[model samples]
Target: MITIGELGEKIVATWLEPQNYQILHHRWHCRWGEIDLIALDNHNSELVFMEVKTRKPQNWDQNGLEALNINKQKRIYTTAQIFLSKNPLWQNYNCRFDLILLTYIIRKNNSNQGLIKILNSNQIMYENYIFTIKNHLKNVL
Candidate 1:
């Protein structure tokens, strides 16, 4: 099963794809840490380094943006530097950091003995799940 973090990366990647962003990496890691998504913004000719935060609707106190504290931001910035060093092709492009916060809500379906039905053919114990982009902040760092 895909973890929540992985799912969030995919969701953000999908959202960016339609907006003229070409994904270069997902979960790119270095000695510092992992960057959720790295892409080339075709529309702006910039390299984008993104951090994604995923949480249940009830888990966040003041939106997920608060989770990207100073230390986390520093780590992400360092990681992006390492990435650019390794992938020199993007070194010349302007770079920017972004944050994407996703809120996921899962609703219980008690109609069929706790089974959630979908499309009248698929049934899942965990169903009626919805994901929304609670925030997308560009140039976060």
Candidate 2:
């Protein structure tokens, strides 16, 4: 099963596609840490290193951007540097760090109203759940 964080990344990628961003990598990891998404803006020839934070609607005390502290920023920058060093072709592109915050509302349907049954096992049908993105923030750092 796909985790909520992974699902959020997909939603963010989908949101970025129409805006001319081509995803180069997702979950790129190095000794420093992992970059949530690495994308190139075809329209402006800029490299984007993104940090994605996914939170359920009721779990947030602050905006996701605020969660990226100085230490996290340092780690992300170091990782980006490593990425640029390993990929010389992209070294010339202007790079920027961005933060994407996704807030999802997950609804469990116990009633049959507006619920789609996907499977039937022992005469028990699985109700469809909905995941909705409530907010997205970009270029926070």
Candidate 3:
């Protein structure tokens, strides 16, 4: 079963693909940590390391922003360095760190709610609470 976090990443990837970002890796892991998405921006020829935060509308930590503290930032930075080292081909590309925030909300009234059911079909979901892209902060780090 795909976890909610993984599903959120997939949704972000799906949205990014149509906008000229080619997903190079998903859930890229290393000793330090993992990168939710590694994408290449065709428009600018840049390498992007994206961190996704999915949460219900009502929660502490400012919808997961607080979770990316200095410690977490260090881990992600180190992981990105490792990735670039292993893939020398992208070493010359300008790199950036991005943040994607997803909020769980119901479609009927567009209110924050808990996720109920999800389907793996191309349609994304059947209708309860869905993760919506709340923000796309580029070059966050």
Candidate 2 lDDT by residue in tens digits, 7-111? 667667766776799999998989999899999988988899998777766665454656799999999999999999999999999898888766655456556
Report backbone clashes per prediction.
0, 0, 0
Instruction: Give me the overall lDDT of model 2.
Output: 0.72
Candidate 3 lDDT trough over 10 residues, lowest sum = 117-126
lDDT of 3 at 40: 97
lDDT of 1 by residue, 43-96 (tens): 989999999888887774555778899999999989999998998898899999
Task: Order the candidates by lDDT, highest first.
Answer: 3, 1, 2
Pick by lDDT: 2 or 3, better one? 3
Instruction: Give TM-scores for every candidate, taking all chains together and pairing residue i with residue i.
Output: 0.82, 0.77, 0.83
lDDT of 1: 0.78
TM-score of 3: 0.83
Give the best candidate by TM-score.
3
Q: Candidate 2: TM-score?
A: 0.77
Per-residue lDDT for 50-102 in model 3, tens only? 99998888879777788899999999999999999999999999999999887
User: What local lDDT does model 1 show for residue 90?
Assistant: 86
**What is the Å distance of residue 29 in model 3 from its true position?**
0.5
- List the pairs of residues colliding in candidate 3: none
